[model samples]
Target: MKEQLVFATNNPHKIEEIRRQLGDRYTFRSLQDIGCTEDIPETETTLEGNARLKARHVKSNYGQDCFSEDSGLEVAALGNAPGVDTAHYAGPQRDAEENNTKLLSELGDRKDRLARFRTVICLIQGDTETLFEGVCEGRIATSPVGHGGFGYDPVFVPTEGDGRTFAQMKQDEKVRISHRGRAIAKLQEYLKSRSGADRPTG
Candidate 1:
């Protein structure tokens, strides 16, 4: 039987991305499907810490394998001001536009727009935890780019391939080169190698 994994997030987009990446190798479900409605604190100071915390929470609470990811945009010009605090850069409940505005305002007059997006993924099964990370270097645009992607996608242009930002890329294209995509690819490789192996029992 295929292993059932819970993605420790309420974001449908993220869950869909993960599902597409993993395909038939694993059956993945999100917090909503698992009836996890409780909001968890993301008070960690680092991306990896936050990813691990979310995965650990679902694994412990639901007694099932869980996966989680924490991603951020680090602008070199702003001293990485929004690295781990990407979600709350403006305020606890602010949306993407507000967060992007805050970031742009902080980057005033700074000509060096070098920045990178990082994603840390954590996979927890029982007491075992595995971590994977990926990064995409780019520069922050003076204004938003295409309107396709969410969060900070519109304001960042990658260092390779496309002249347009991530927001302009198709979903499959984005998944192929995105930081989260790269990280999840590593996990997929790991799982592919252990495809037929049995999951460790408690």
Candidate 2:
């Protein structure tokens, strides 16, 4: 039987991405699956802190071994203005379109479009906590491109890919190079090692 693992998130996009990446090895459950309806606190000022906060909340309240991730788009020209505030950059509504518009408006006519997407994952199992981080360097597009992804995907073009924005790429294509993907890869490695170590002697 696959080891059951909880992912502490209510966002379907995040849940889908993580499930696609790690579903083969483990049984995945979301916050709703465990009946966590309250909005978990995310008052952390840093990506890692926020991720840790969510993971700890689930583990403490639900007594489940779970993981949580926080992602942000940091634009160099903006001095990473929305590093920790990526979700609510425009306002507290967390509207992606509004956030994108605000980002573009603030970045109008700027030549420097260098940016990066960063993801931090915090995993809690029993009393042990582990963190993993991944970064994808890229540039912010002047306008939204495709509609394949959520949040900043429509305006983010990864350095590892062609000029197309993340939203223009297929799900598998994007996942292979996304910051979240890289972090998930590291998590899979760690989970594999843990599984191996927990196995009984032959």
The top-ranked prediction according to TM-score is 2
Alpha carbon lDDT of each predicted model: 0.85, 0.93
Per-residue lDDT over 1-202 for candidate 2, one digit per residue giving the tens place of the 0 to 100 score: 7888888988999888888988677888889999999998789999999999999898888888899999999999899979999999999999999999999999999999999999999999888999999999999998999989999999999999999999999999999999999999999999999989999988
How does residue 43 of candidate 1 score in lDDT?
82
True-structure lDDT of candidate 1: 0.85
Clashing pairs in 2: none
What TM-score would you give candidate 1 relative to the actual structure?
Answer: 0.92
TM per candidate: 0.92, 0.97
User: Which runs in model 1 stand beyond 4 Å of their true positions?
Assistant: 196-202
